[model samples]
Target: DCSLAAEQLKNSPRHKAYLEGVSLRQLQKLYSLLKGHLGGESLAESLENDKELAKRKSIMDELFEKNRKKKDDPDFIYDIEVEFPQDEQLESCGWDAESGEEI
Candidate 1:
């Protein structure tokens, strides 16, 4: 029903600016506020009837869970070595140029 309404809105030329102006955070907040006021019991009941929406919601839930897990993981490391030297421009730390062994 929301998608049907969204499709109807897409046809309206005036709705473009109004829809485009709304940020993702604003839309999410609005959805949460509306859902809270509407109550959760009937929401679940109605969502159960919309199989397509329910499927999409389930996938989104799974993805969000995975994302949270990844964020909370202790072993995750994001390291970047940006300035790797080329072979010709490389400097010796302990190895000689000819022998390539520790000095």
Candidate 2:
């Protein structure tokens, strides 16, 4: 993903204009610096399946029920969603074009 993002940004006229005389290497370094600030992917492979998700929901429901008795907020609600990254996505981001391996 980082590599793709870098490529797109490098090709973008606005990005080029903004950076002015910055070299390709410097732009790449900038991308790496900014990518770190976007936060990491949230993935627990064990929790990707429906069965595991249901189990997790059940545990959360129990905890919420217990907390309900101590609180008076009836409008409160909790929701959870999990996503599994695709192979192409993993490759585009995980594999560094320059290094030709997972970063």
Candidate 3:
């Protein structure tokens, strides 16, 4: 959704930059949170079958979906915008200076 909002703001120099920055920070935070979780195991599991911990982990996974995507494009993995050269009009239009399309 954020990526779509950014697209709508692309025509406005100020708003586009602002939204891009905010979305970028969101991405960074999401990355750090996922990295932390992926690199470690559950801190505690009070449930004998670990059901609670499993549920907690699943919720976290859904929040960002580190491996979530459509057609394996790197951009769809997040709420950030993506650019494909052939789909753009301007010279290098797909390449937004603020964020890489291939990201």
Candidate 4:
């Protein structure tokens, strides 16, 4: 899903133009949320059927370790969809092209 978002943004003149409008931290947070939501191992079993999303897995693997350490509760399921921007909104807005996520 995130990958498709990136690709979609890449094809969009408005998204490309808006890329310079956000910050790094914002991008990272968005990436983490998307990864935790539409990611392959997410609770949504049907998400796995998305070959486009699966092929374009997270590029922010490094954030995983840092994020795990920062997690307020390790045992928490940490539902991201509720924790941050709604999927529909993010999809409509698109993310940083370089990282293929919010920034």
TM agreement with the true structure for every prediction: 0.25, 0.31, 0.20, 0.25
In model 1, the clashing pairs are none
- What range of 10 consecutive residues in model 3 has the weakest lDDT sum? 41-50
RMSD to true structure for each model, in Å: 19.3, 18.4, 18.8, 19.6
Off by over 4 Å in 3: 1-22, 41-103
lDDT of 4 by residue, 1-103 (tens): 4555555555578776676666545555465467667655564544444554655555455556556644567675655565665565444333444564553
Report the number of the highest-TM-score candidate. Answer: 2
Please report how far candidate 4 places residue 30 from its true position, in Å: 0.3
**Ranking of predictions according to TM-score:** 2, 1, 4, 3
Worst 10 residues of 2 by lDDT: 41-50
Each candidate's number of clashing pairs is 0, 2, 0, 3
Q: Which candidate is the best by lDDT?
A: 2
Output the lDDT of residue 76, model 4: 56
Q: Is candidate 1 or candidate 4 better by TM-score?
A: 1
Instruction: Estimate the overall C-alpha local distance difference test score of candidate 4.
Output: 0.55
